[model samples]
Target: MFRFFESLIDPYPGAVPETPPRRLLAFLFHYSRPLLPLLLAMTFFAAMVSVVEVMFFAFMGELVDWLAEAKRERFFADHGGRLLGMAALALVAFPLLVLCKSLVTHQSLFGNYPMRVRWLAHRYLLEQSLPFFQDEFAGRVSQKVMQTALAIRETVVKLMDVFVYVVVYFTGALVLVGRSEPWLMAPLLVWLLGYLVLMRVFVPRLKLISMAQADARAHMTGRIVDSYTNIQTLKLFAHTQAEQAYARGAMDGFMETVHRQMRLVTQLTVSLQTLNSLLLVTMAGFAILSWHQSLISLGAIAVAIGLVMRLRMMSDWILWEVAGLFENLGTLQDGINTIAQAQAVSDSPKAQELSVPQGEIRFDKVTFSYEAGPRGMDDGNHAARQANVFDNLSLTLRPGERVGLVGASGAGKSTLVNLLLRFFDIGDGRILIDGQDIATVTQASLRRHIGMVTQDTSLLHRSIRDNIRYGRPEASEEEIIEAARRAHADTFIRQASDPQGRTGYDAHVGERGVKLSGGQRQRIAIARVLLKDAPILVLDEATSALDSEVEAAIQEQFYALMEGKTVIAIAHRLSTIAMLDRLVVMDQGRIIESGTHQELLELGGTYAGLWQRQSGGFLGLEAAADAAPIGAAEGQTRGEGEASVPDRQRQ
Candidate 1:
């Protein structure tokens, strides 16, 4: 009962697995466990109602025959009182059980199970490793969560309402018809066999169409959401019509499936009607013939007629019920395909909370490769790919050391950071913080000791206060304000007000902070990291969004934030890392040089060449390694500079 009630409002307080449910029946059982008993009890009550209905129809038929009898005077004297008593019993029981069924139907349909399914799906999906979300469409995933729950609810309710009633009512018809005239049983048996055959032929076709429809619907939603997320790109390129056509294509496929499925349904109805008419005519004719021969009474003919007519009504209803069942089942199958996925990274069984005292970071011969295929499994030739990233990389940072990592794109700079965070496990390596291998510590606890500011910031669709406070959710207002001030974000935050009339720190930032400028978003990110105030800090082009003046202004704050902290800063802009304690230069996944800014210049190696190519504070290593300084031409076109060896090289 608790599971059922909980399922209505939220997924039961049990762990949701990260993989697709093993099978549909088992999956439904787990989610619908709480409602099972109630549903069964409801089914029983519905069956009783069907029994009452059959009895009522039988009594009415008998009463009609009794009224039409030639020996009416004799019948009234013999059986009139008992007939009236049975009639009264049927009258009271029919409506009473109907009222009970209605109450149960109301509860089951509106009990909030859909809401719970959505919540559970979202919660479990968010818990999946980052790659999973990256691979799926946000809108499509969202659509499936919604579609699955509704489909399940409709399917369950309809099963009890239509299916349970059909079984009991059909049985009642067979028994009543058999007792009335044994010859009439032949028609019922034939119709039953025909119905089973019809389902076997049509149900599989409906399931296929339903699956197709679900896929097309999800695709359509994903296309629309993709367009919306990139609305600016469409407007800028004037491609709104093209995107619309793309979405229309998906809709066209959906419409086509619906057309085909509806045609099948039309055929099904025609077939069912044919069978129903035959059953009705055959049974009624047989009953009349038997009665004419005096082999059965007129009451038996009337009862046979009632059962055949009842069967006709039920057969018509069953056509739709079966169609709906397959439709919903297909939807659930589709939803499960997208919603359940295996986790690439998960916490170890014995992982413990990290204790960061001095914040020393060590990379112990760390090596990794980009995944060869889905699930990050290496198919073959994985060693070739592995060699391209890091073979036996080793690095260590002392407490309070500030290290700058300079590298060309794909030079393993960001991969180093990824390894530290354990976003993906290493192929063969250990990253330790304060002597604790990061892999040995719980991800949540390891992350607690480190704060990061990435180049592309993604803020939640929330207020400025909440985004800032995200760094330290429990931080007081004063602390939040202080962090914002330190990040040079207080000025803009105070000046801003959203359309909803929320001003200052309370102002809403639209999705991914679309309402704010790139610089503003970067500052908010900085404020978040500052508020975090972790022992270890990572800055990946952290101030790339700021102008030269703003960057200079915040340089003081950045220094202050780095005080007594172990910092790993990645900068395409060479100037940002000049003041760090040491500079590490990497190329082709190996650290080529490690020294102070001045020492690297004196070495006249790869570091010296990159420094000379530095134009407008950026190291342009990708454009032309030998080209004369292009910074003056394009304000830092990728890695172009003429190196007239510096005086520092001689020093």
Candidate 2:
């Protein structure tokens, strides 16, 4: 039975709106559509429960009058059937209705509703473009996703329950009072008006404060998470005090918002208690005066006082319910800021799967700038935005060609690779793999045909085997080990174990592979990419962390891995790429020189000068010197740097 209720709604709905509504009511209605019928059934049961309680009160008044006016011998004869029927309802039917409401609520809606909401919200977040994540703290974004789900569930379900019960219960009370003496309804009506007035004044103020509180909490969480993620850097720099101070600033902001919210809550409590006291006093006085004037029965006076006392108790509960509703609504609004935005990047409706046979790559006059704003929006900011990373830049690699990229920092080397991967859509022009434009192909398919290894490799906190198999899920165990061996990663992996004693491939890597050395992490990353075996490969300072012996050991394997693939390699250690088929030297986002290493050396251009500046196989340039054009120097004839290459190579 429990499982039956849990399965009533699919937790992961197949279809969802691309953009969620921002307005509270619309947002609630949108997510609630699947649960609406069950929710309405619950509301009906709540209303019936309210009606039963009111009937019980009326029955009590009737019984009081019956005992006073009837003889003891004839009491059962006069009211026996009705009394027995009411007893049965109280014992059986009333409990059943309450049970039905509870089942729909606790057993079904409460759990499934939030889970469904979170699933959809998480899906929407996954669809967001790379820049969206780059712009926000990861921890804060996840917190909003989690908080919004619970807040929406609490706001909708509790508000529904409270609203239905109050309305039905109040209406029944008013009718019971009016039947005794229509004038007796005055106090009840006045009390209700004052209650609404209080809600009107206090609820909006609570909502605003709650929203501020939610934002502050998220900000504080983001700061702490940032510190933790960079804990190694903190420890290395010995800045524990500075880290604490940085986190404290966010903590103080959060406390200020919390203080404001508590102040409003205190004020609201005092005002509500005062109003409830007046209602109880006024209703009791009126009931007694009506009975003295002979305008109402003893039973009517009893019912009036009873109803007023019950309301007095309920008013406090109602106050809290209304306050919590607005507070959750405020939280929902904060969540909406993260979850309701439309996807900045999405596949075109008619996009096709990318197919790469020859692995030919082309950049046809591509132009791009990160400063163009997300979604490539062009506004007044465009005029003041930073210069384009690539402007009318064009490059191509023939099938199975191996080329190296040589440039200083900010020379557009990485940006060019990012554009080819379609991490950001180009501001103009097109990138094609083979003949199909990348923009016209599904992103998943485009990425599947390319494999890349970066200097700053990050691994999932999963088993070594699982991380390697991630490149191809169906790969067998033998294949995984072989790939690791080729990447020369198998030696240390055999010795690897987590604190849990799980050894070798089964052992878990710590967060972001922090348990592993930089070289070990890079080797695992290389192994994974090797398993992927894509037709196109990119290496961006891929071996920067390895010691000379290990680097030399893997150099042959890397050459083999590059066979029959179009490769683009980037390295500060120019020697690693100097032996490739060709070298392309970029400066200020344009390809300034391109040729074989020997040819470029013969040209005595930018590439030759950069080669001349290398020490121990790595670019050794001072900050200011790298900025200036390093073309052939004055008083040095062509091939002057080329003639000295052998001597430096021997060093």
Each model's C-alpha lDDT? 0.79, 0.85
Steric overlap count per candidate: 3, 0
lDDT string for model 1 (443-515, tens) is 8898888999988888999999999999999999999999999889999999999999999999999988989
Q: Which run of 10 residues does model 1 get worst, by summed lDDT?
A: 642-651
- Cα RMSD to native, each candidate? 6.1, 5.7
Best by TM-score: 2
Candidate 1 error regions (>4 Å)? 1-20, 69-96, 99-105, 108-110, 155-161, 372-388, 625-651
The reply for model 2, stretches above 4 Å from the true place, is: 373-376, 623-651
Cα lDDT, model 1, residue 497:
97
Model 2 CA lDDT for position 539: 94
Model 2 C-alpha lDDT per residue in residues 1-651, reported as the tens digit of each score:
878887888878889446789888888887888798988888889999999999988988888788879899999999999899999999999999988988889888888899999999898888788778867888899889889999988888777887999999999999999999888899889889999999999999988988988988999999898888778889999999999999999999999988888888898889888988888888888888888998887788788888888998999898888988998999998988788887766788899999998999999988776666333476767556656667788999999999999876656687788778887777788898998999899988988999999888889989999999988889999999999999899989999999999999999988888889999999999899999999999999989999998899888888998999999999978899999998998766778899999999999977877788788888864442634473212113112211222211111
TM-score result, candidate 2: 0.94
Q: What is the lDDT of candidate 1?
A: 0.79
Top lDDT model: 2
